[model samples]
Target: MAADLVSRVKTDPNFIELEAKRGAFGWTIAISMVVIYFAFIFMVAFFKDALSVQVYGVITLAFPLGILVLFSAFVLVGIYVVRANGEFDDLTKKIVEKAR
Candidate 1:
């Protein structure tokens, strides 16, 4: 019974759409994070003087930039969560109902 339902869901057009959307969205977020992280790393490796400059007393430019990298991860997660909770959930519900 479970296998039959799985097969049915796999054949559904909505299931295909859901998988494609999630895959594309997931890759986009992953690539965005990689780009951000590598950009920071490259800056550290090849542009030390720029990141080392003092932004304020006892604080360097690197401090805020590092914080920005962390903040961006959270922002990206929030973006995924919003879409998942909305469109993804709707499509998932449809898939499950159709499968049943």
Candidate 2:
């Protein structure tokens, strides 16, 4: 019975839509994060002199860029959570209901 229900859900249109949407959205977020992180890493590796420049008293330019990279992860997760709770959850509910 469980297998049958799972098969039915897999064949459902909502399931397909959910899979495609989730996959694409996940990839987009992952790629964005990778680019942002790598850009910071590259800057640190290749542009130490620039990062070492004084931004304010006792603060270097690298300080804010590092903070931004950390905060960007949190912000991206928050965005994913919002979308998952809204669109993804709705599609999931529909798929389960249809399976039943």
Candidate 3:
């Protein structure tokens, strides 16, 4: 039964489309997050003095940038969840129905 379902899934066009969409979306998000994360790292590494300088009276650039990195992670996760729950889930259901 499992093998048959697997064979069906492999042959299904919806499954192919689902894989392509998921892979593309996942890679795009992953690359974007990596760039954002590495940029923050590079700034901290190369411009520590600049980041350490007081920005808003007492707050430093590092503090805000750190918070931004954290916030961006949450935002990215939310984006993935929204796409998975909406478009991805719909595609998944269609694939499953086609397999059955």
Predicted structure with the largest TM-score when compared to the true one: 2
lDDT of every model, 2 decimals: 0.96, 0.94, 0.92
Model 1 clash count equals: 0
lDDT of 2 by residue, 1-100 (tens): 6898878888899999999999999999999999999999999999999999999998999999999999999999999999999999999999877776
Candidate whose lDDT is highest: 1
Candidate 3 residue pairs in clash (backbone atoms < 3 Å): none
Q: In model 2, where is the ten-residue run with the lowest total lDDT?
A: 1-10
Candidate 1: tens digits of C-alpha lDDT, residues 21-60:
9999999999999999999999999999999999899899
lDDT (10s digit) by residue, model 3, range 1-100: 6998898898788888889999999999899899999999999889899899898989998999999999999999999999999999999999888776
Off by over 4 Å in 1: 1-4, 54-59
Model 2 CA lDDT for position 25: 96
Residue 5 C-alpha lDDT in model 3? 85
- Candidates sorted on lDDT, descending: 1, 2, 3
- Scored by lDDT, model 1 comes in at 0.96
- Backbone collisions counted per model: 0, 0, 0
Model 3 ranges with Cα > 4 A deviation: 1-7
